[model samples]
Target: VEMMENVSKYRYANVPNLDAQVVEIPYADGRLSMVMMLPNREGLHSLQTLFRDLSYSPLASTLASLRETELLLQIPKFSIESKLNLRPTLEALGIKDIFGFDANLSGILAGKSAQIGSVLHDAKIEVNEQGTVAAAVTGISVIPLMGSTMDTFRADRPFLFAIVDQSTGSMIFAGRVVQPTWAAPSPLG
Candidate 1:
């Protein structure tokens, strides 16, 4: 997998083993963040349970646990895109009429007869050692002994991350990194 490695101050928290470890990488404005959760163990079941627990408890608790600390951080550099057809979901929620031929959407179509065909939603996020994809990379370079006891947070395994608005504690976007989607040249080059 592509990687984003760096040595920098990170806002981190070690949640229960059943959950995952948290790391907060704030944006330039300081009002937003890239919150990463590294599972304590490997596998799909662990990820499923971690997400389940996160849904049960708002990520705000994890966000609140952030405290600044230095570490040797290494994370995957990935871009994830999700395209979902929400027609069934909307229809299940009593929004079926919009998809009917007789459904009137002229008000939104400038007097044209346009019924909803399908509700398709698409979202993509590209992240690297920097903050978000759009954010700049600001990694620190330090020389350390190979066997030294420096703290390290390496996401060489499966992990999850979310883009959040810190002020309102809202998750703007979230995704998982299980493996490399494609083979690419390293960023260090």
Candidate 2:
């Protein structure tokens, strides 16, 4: 497979640079594949935009080569949002039949546990190894009164909403909120 060939080449190259050129090769199965080191969010976005622009280039051979080849894009764990954006970007590049997992499914595919609570009730604070006060983490807790009855309070999780570039793995914007609002759709949800 193209992916396997790219892995072999990567193993052979001893001193690869951060922004190395993409490699192309023809496989025994008569298929072409392009291999390149994955870029950060900005770089990925730039590449997507560039491909979109070149989709209708006059150079038929270049365009044909791109059309015939498969791509293996690698990404780290934290770049989920950016990866999500790649779908629309690919569509803009004239790629009509692309496939990928949705955010929640992708998380499970990547072996990440999904957050399944409706409310964050208790918050715990601690210091990290760097000696800085770690951000408060929220959990669920319940308290009971001696005489009257049961009462509970819903708390907020310590997380921020962030916009990211899918290609190059960059956080474009971020904001914190008091509660989980439905204003934005969460892939995790």
Global lDDT of each model?
0.73, 0.25
lDDT of 2 by residue, 124-185 (tens): 22112111101111121112335632211111111222333334334344322222222321
Candidate number achieving the greatest lDDT relative to the actual structure: 1
Q: For candidate 1, write residues 8-112 as lDDT tens digits.
A: 667887787436788887777878888888888878777778888887777887777777877666666777899999999999899987899899887788878
Candidate 2, residue 3: how far the Cα is off, in Å: 10
Pairs in clash, predicted candidate 1 = none
Q: In terms of TM-score, how similar is model 2 to the real structure?
A: 0.19
The top-ranked prediction according to TM-score is 1
| TM-score of candidate 1 to 2 decimals | 0.83
Q: TM-scores, in order shown?
A: 0.83, 0.19
